[model samples]
Target: MTTVFRKALGALPRLGVQVLDLGPGAAVVSRRGGYTATKMSGDSWMVGGKRPRTRTTADGWGLHKAAAGDLCARHVADLLANYEVNCVFDVGANKGQYGRQLRELGYRGRIVSFEPVPDALARLRKSAERDPEWRVYPFALGRSESFEDMHLGWKTMNSLLQPSAYGQRRYKRFTDTRKEQVRIRRLDEVMDEALEGIAEPRPYLKMDTQGFDMEVFAGAGRRTADFVGMQSEVAVLQLYEGSPRMNEAIAAYEDAGFAITGMYPVTREKTTGRVVEFDCVMARAAAAPSRQG
Candidate 1:
């Protein structure tokens, strides 16, 4: 590849363009909008029109980063498309970030988001109001139906489990700032009710409940078989009290008949480069005995 072509390929993610290799010495660039840029030999490029404005939100940046690096969103898109997923259970959906990213990535499935934090839920509701297929629920999913004290942090760090001492020291922004009493329900109890009568619902569950992913899974019960894939935030360090470590989290999911497919780093300790937490994607293992007859 020429230096210019290499640079363009390297910058495509930040530029929000998808490259299609035509052959040696030529490629096509597809952008978010309907415009296309063609790269020819010797630093030569051709564009049909002016470039569209790029997205600047954190979710947009993450999606583009994944697109650039061939990471999380790419795997997610593949799972959704391959499984023909019709429903998405977005657990711990803060401000509908995951749902929004899904739509941007071409997922047209029905989305049911559960968020218990008052402020976050409000924003989530507004974000999904215009989308008829996207529904927002104002409750958390746990091991059972009950009320719990949720520790609220600077932003998305809120969780049912208390922040760990390591978390507080390593990341000051994750310090528990306040507590809120929130209603919690089990996925087994709410899944059918929330997605009643959806035609052939192949659900993809995505959880970002901070340290409470296992509790959420415990509540899923036999309903786990109904899901085609699941994505959860797995902690490397003990970010929250009672939260499972990376190995433990993987083991729990594996025991549930899912196999690890992808791991996307979410945060890292700035100095030591130790992973803080990452998103783990799992699909039902093919070798596992079929739940259906």
Candidate 2:
């Protein structure tokens, strides 16, 4: 019945519906109008018609509640504030979602967003047009400059790495990849220009390039020190083939002189109830202390 319902939803155009599993005996249907209905263990449905109101933090991941926006956005904002971040490089900015969230969270820094997906980049540019502080770039960031085929996943889950078998089995959308050739540039080559005109440029790097975050990080080279803080979406379970696991990614960041400020679960697997990914925020160890200290 679930499979049939999902197929029916897919058949409909512009339905804007997504079915997400929240562990055993729990499922959530999210609709276009910001409505959500959750199926509980005993076949009871908990429905909310309006958009979800999210606070900064909860006891855990808040899985029982309606899908909250990025659980770590506020944390990122806080880190930005703490480090006096004056500019931000929003790598993999999909339609300016993260930039908007940062603004709502009271961050007034300059946002330089990079996106390679044509459709998404168009929307991202439009979103940033009214806000002079927000800038949009039209190429993907990677370890080197070149063109690569990006596999588009569900929503903004597109990546250079192929989705793994586990990802396809857990999320049906992984099977529907539409590849697009995109230009990739190294951050080291563009960093100075991106930061141009920003006074006392204390930068923050926010990356959500699905599984290619490390590559983006590598692109920064020794200039990683230029950032006061950074955020990366690391996989707890390898969703994309060749993507680094959580531990490896964390270690890499630590080795690069960044220390974890906070770690927030992004999503969990249905069957095993394991965290699938995390929005891990880190800051340069030498600069992580709070102003109040």
Candidate 3:
């Protein structure tokens, strides 16, 4: 990328243009107006435009969502309102970032966060001290109850599965191999306890367990339908051993009767400029209220 081109790209975000992909001689950009601009090569740009519509907002949530240019947040806000999400079960709630983001989006519902790592749990607890609606749990949710070793990577990259060679090579932080034996519990087993004090719980489940999302879903078992909506980190490229690919994860959600609402790229491979993983949001199709004539 040339300096002039880089500078221009930097300024595009202010205009609501998000650079989704950039390669050796090509680029893919999208806008809130539902248009995609792709550069084939040598200044040949193909523009795919949708019917323009005004984006008007009166609330703090809409303002934050529009200003941040986060499609995931906007989608989550939509689902919460549509599905009447009164409680959120934040699986893999590392250091309460997701919870904090929820509050920023003006969500005032109950937030129950689960984190197994001692260091992360400590920080997550401290951050929720001022918020009475936010609660924390100190165990990981998985397919079954057992003491399993968790790969403790740098910051929020912790995982239950071992990191692959490609993962370590592509992301240097994954090279860390510190292991901690953490308690793994099934969400179904503790679902009642988690919802004990909450009244009329309409839940949304969000999982970011570093490739362990499938296991967490499995742990939820038959109670998965209790959640009106869910969000998971689906991987296009396998980063951890035994982690299901994007297709498999999406299939699981679909089989469970959820319809995909949105997918926003979370990370990209630097060399290939391909999406490594994305936040996939899905809602139970049957949960939507029928429209009256």
lDDT of 3 by residue, 116-153 (tens): 99999999999899999998999999999999999886
Model 2 over residues 170-237: C-alpha lDDT tens digits? 87888887898999999989989988998778999999998999999999999998888899998988
Writing each residue's lDDT as its tens digit, candidate 1 over 1-293 gives 36887777768868778775555567667775354445433344444443348733533444333332245776788778877788999999999988998998789989999999989989999999999999888999999889989888668878788778997887687744788899999999988877787977788889989889999999999999888889999888998899998899899888888888888777755455566788899888563235432
TM-score each candidate.
0.75, 0.77, 0.75
Question: Per model, how many backbone clashes are there?
Answer: 0, 0, 0
Better structure of 2 and 3 per lDDT: 3
C-alpha root-mean-square deviation, each candidate: 9.0, 12.2, 12.2
Q: For model 2, what is the C-alpha lDDT against the true structure?
A: 0.81
The number of the candidate with the highest TM-score is 2
- Candidate 3, residue 192: Cα displacement in angstroms equals 0.9
After superposition, candidate 3 runs with Cα above 4 Å error: 1-69, 291-293
Ranked candidates (TM-score, high to low)? 2, 3, 1
TM-score, candidate number 3: 0.75
lDDT of 3: 0.82
Ranking by lDDT: 3, 2, 1
Task: Give the winner by lDDT.
Answer: 3
Candidate 2 matches the true fold with a TM-score of 0.77
